[model samples]
Target: MQTDSKTIYTPFVRAKDSVWEVMSDVLLALIPCAVISYFAYGEAPLFVMFVAVISAMVGEFIFAGIFLKKWNTLLDGSAIVTAILLAFTLAPFTPWYVVAFGSAMAVIFGKILWGGLGRNMFNPALVGREFMTVFFPLVMTSRTIWYNKDYVNFQDLNIFNFLGNGGFTEYMNSIFFKPSGAIGEYSVLLLVLGGLYLLLRRRISWHIPFGLLVTFFILLQIFAFKDIKFSLGGILLGTLFMATDMPSSASTKMGKLYYGAMIGLVAMLCLLNDVKYEYMSYSILLVNGFVIPINWVFKPKVWGENINLKERVGAGVLLTIGIVATTYALVYLHHFDLVRYLIFAYILIVIGRFSFSKQLH
Candidate 1:
């Protein structure tokens, strides 16, 4: 007896979930952070969120109608997420008009120009933040603008000093409840909660965030041991919320590791050199531009396929050269105190790589 086989059409097996559902989950994950920001910073943060979200929705609707010829695409909820994220990156006291403009830029230039949602090469919120940083540098980095009544005095308080001064409880409370820095980055505890929620929902994988954060912590500890909180806060905000962005991050598992390591390396370079304003945003965006190439190079392996030894060797050599050259240039040009430690770190990494390669062989 012969059996007939059936093949499903284009979509194959239909997904029980939709774009709207994924976006909804992301928004839900963000709610804890949103509530914390509102309570910490008072009404300004709420207003910023409101303006940003509304502006993003309007921009998405108009742009989708004009370019995609489909207004219904706004129902996917991406625009809301973009707006909220962009707002989070902004100062709580940033003018309402600026928030609106940034939201529009995120939707029009960042998303629509790249052919809508999934096609965008960079995260729309980050693009908006970058645009503002370039054009409104003073506003974006203004100390006066960032300060609120709830702000804590972080001056002269490195992580070590904060702990040694018997202010550990105060420091922990500040990290959890006090408003400082960006509108959304105020509460490390809330951000962790939100990140955990996303992880549990399987909306995002652990690879990128894990690699980026671990690399950043290790490098930061080696270079700036006193400022552990600064590194921790940066990793929590940038890795979890920004670097793991779905559209811009690496696709393959191995690619994510490389992508995240690059992000951490670049970010450390910025931090070590005192490039204070928007360094994390810049690092992630720079890596975002390289995601396609990284994905191609670290493409997912096929089962039972032979590995290309030549390609792997060539890549290894190029990476070593890149690291050595970068370190040499930094030491030669800037002569920064951290460069010496970085050189030591690179040597250790090289040793580790060779040892691992030998074990594999």
Candidate 2:
């Protein structure tokens, strides 16, 4: 008699939680914010959310099927999350076509084109928002929009007035009942509540958010001392929603703190330079591009591993070089218009090579 036995896979142990489970938890957390947005901004917010979410899902399906030849990833729910986030970053009166286009860019370039879910280097929603802000600034920062019209008088509302005086209550009421910003950004109370729920569920770590808030508060106090209220708004929205993104963020504990701090500092700089619209998203995207390098510098040590003096020195040298190169590149690009196209082309080639090289490995 012959027995038909199959070999078991290594350890055969499955995790209690899965990607879909975590995605579900994130979606649940956003429900309060979504409901709050509808009440605060009326039907427009809901309409944009619907259009964005559906477009993102459909874009992912079509792109994955045509390019990757594997279409089963739609069930992962990542596209939905990206859609919600992108919608949150949009102005309340954004057109349906713009929503659709942004969602497609997010799912395609930000996610699928980078080799799908886990391999994406930047947050998909942020990428979409940044793209829209660059190409369709008028649509994204429309002064004629209903929400913008309401907040028009408070355009220069500062932190001292918001917190020091009787402005706290007024600020709270504005954010809660009559928000005048992006759909999700209108309700700080709801977003905070959602973030707290995620914290309780251990769906997200606190280091990034905490660091971001602290750094942002301190920096605004020093730099734009008068605009603390404006700074606070950016801090809350970016920290709780954007900067806390897991995959696009650093993995190590120290790396998260550094990443958050970087975001805060960049945000302050943007404010100082008069970058008025979606500066938080821009700062977060700028930091996201450095996540890999940050991880490399802050990688966790192996158990029983020893650090050599030479290795430490080499790391310091590499870090210094990276900083200098980045600073020089920024300065050069800012001052020189003639070499901009050439530099852009070169950077694109380098990025393409790096991406393809990763695939080969």
> Which model scores highest in TM-score?
2
Model 2 over residues 26-101: C-alpha lDDT tens digits?
A: 8998887777776555678888899999999999999888766779888888899999988887777788998998
Off by over 4 Å in 2: 1-15, 146-172, 224-231, 308-361
Model 1: per-residue lDDT, tens digit, 174-204? 6676566677777787788888888998777
Ten consecutive residues with minimal summed lDDT in candidate 2? 4-13
Candidate 1 residue 31 Cα shift, in angstroms, is 1.2
Q: What is the lDDT of candidate 1?
A: 0.71
Q: What is the TM-score of each candidate against the true structure?
A: 0.78, 0.79
Instruction: Report how far off residue 55 is in candidate 2 (Å).
Output: 0.9
